[model samples]
Target: MTNNLLNENYWTTRYLNKSTAWDTGEVTFPIKQYLDQLDNKEINILIPGAGNGYEVIYAFEKGFKIIHILDISFLPLKQFEEACPDFPKAQIHHQNFFEHIGQYDLILEQTFFCSLPPILRSDYVKKMIELLKPNGKLVGVLFGIDFQKEGPPFGGQMKEYRKLFSKEFEIVKLEPCINSIPPRMGTELFFSLRKIQ
Candidate 1:
């Protein structure tokens, strides 16, 4: 990870100090719309880099119990546990996303990708493919504009993201996010990519 780009301690400290500006504090619109259309409740789902875990709570409340939440820092996981006490303790994971071992039918990407070094992006694509079951989908939002500053919320353009993710994932959906929150309205892209067979 880049020295300036927030890694485990950087992110953990953000949570510890309640300085997580990236945190939406609740499920955002694009993901919420995606979840609303889901007809199956039995598919195994995973959300890595799951800080605050509002989406996990959203899914759990809507009958999606076969969900796993992972984070590199335990701080946010602890907060999530308190926020949703009924969620299974076993489902909360504190570990690196690349090191996590599990086959998931669906993996939701929130703010995780941008938090790492830009050089790790390709590896992120490959690892997402590895963690998924055949035909499993990696669905969520990505920043669509490059930030001028060094970042944990590092951003990139659509063409770059499309090229990076194409090698391992079939580009099923990668477009400007129409339903993002006000602050993120024009800067986010909602994507859904399936592991290539």
Candidate 2:
């Protein structure tokens, strides 16, 4: 189902038809706040499922020299390229997240996790562990409420996330996001998990 439902064609079609309700057009509050507090400009960072990646642009503008953005669909990556002409083309990875192999000091998640099939959640955790350097982090927001609709914007609760992630990570912060966008307010959880040895 994942190979069919959440594949490149599915997302590429979403981008072509302007069906991206998840595209916030700018950086959302929780992630922006996290980025604002980062003191290191040289940290290796990766943003996967980074559709029209506003966070990538934001990090680059802040002088982060090692920012990589990946999208299975080439559509959003193309859009990002046109939008940020100075960003190095080599840094944009047009590939599947599961097939991506690299180490990062930090991996920023926005809408990527929930977009995957819930059955692949375990794979997501394992792959995250593979991608992070020792003590590196996976930080971002996740849906805190169950959605009434069938979705790529799938919903999940904190309890499930805790159970799934705690086995492999040091759960630093997994709580209600106090600074989500107005439409998503009270429905999101901000999380920061450190990879365990």
Candidate 3:
């Protein structure tokens, strides 16, 4: 946690004050499309930094039962509980992403990576590898442009992301996102990486 501003209290306060502009209020298009094409319903899944658990709701509704949602801020988790009362309570985790320990068959990356200070990007990659089962996939979208201001929505280019992730995972898909939400349209990269055996 080198970035003091990214700690739990900071995020909790943002949620408390309704400052979460990163939230789209729905599962973004790229992740939803990726999940729709997956055939397996039994694999264990983890979504780290799962803000409102929108994707968790989508996955659960689509018949994926073994899903987990983790967040540093309990505020959103509490709201998520209210939104999906039927989702198993045990599957909702309030914890730091780096401190979480579990093996997952799939790890979905949403806005989590960019929310951290850019210095923690390598730690994020290493932790993703540690959390995944052998051959497990890490899939989702990343911002493809460098932001003009300091960012919880920090952004980076494709070449930098590819170089960073390739150290631990086999780069499977790292390209411009064709299905991003309108505001994010040309600025997002859809990616899938497999943990190296």
Query: lDDT of each structure?
Result: 0.89, 0.94, 0.92
Segments in model 3 whose C-alpha atoms lie over 4 Å from true places: none
What does candidate 3's lDDT look like per residue over 1-197, in tens digits?
45555588989999999999989999989889999999999999999899899999999999999999999998999999999999998899999999999999999999999898888889898899899999999999999999998887889999999899989999989999999999989999999999999
- Quote the lDDT for 43 in model 3: 97
- Model 2 stretches astray by more than 4 angstroms: none
lDDT of 3: 0.92
Poorest 10 consecutive residues of model 3 by lDDT? 1-10
Q: Write the per-residue lDDT of candidate 1 for residues 1-197, one digit (tens) a residue.
A: 57534357877777788888889889988888899999999999999888889999999999998999999888989889999999999899988888889999999988888788788888788888889999999999999999988776889999998889887889999999999999998999999999999
- With a 3 Å backbone cut-off (N, CA, C), the pairs that clash in candidate 1 are none
Local lDDT at 136 for model 3: 95
lDDT of 2: 0.94
- lDDT string for model 2 (1-197, tens) is 67765589988998889999999999899988999999999999999999999999999998987999999999999989999999998899999999999999999999999898898999999999999999999999999999998887888999999999999999999999999999999999999999998
Which TM-score value belongs to model 2? Answer: 0.98
Q: Using Cα atoms with residue i matched to residue i, what is each candidate's TM-score against the true structure?
A: 0.96, 0.98, 0.97
Clashing pairs in 3: none
Task: Please state every model's RMSD to the true fold in angstroms.
Answer: 1.4, 0.8, 1.1
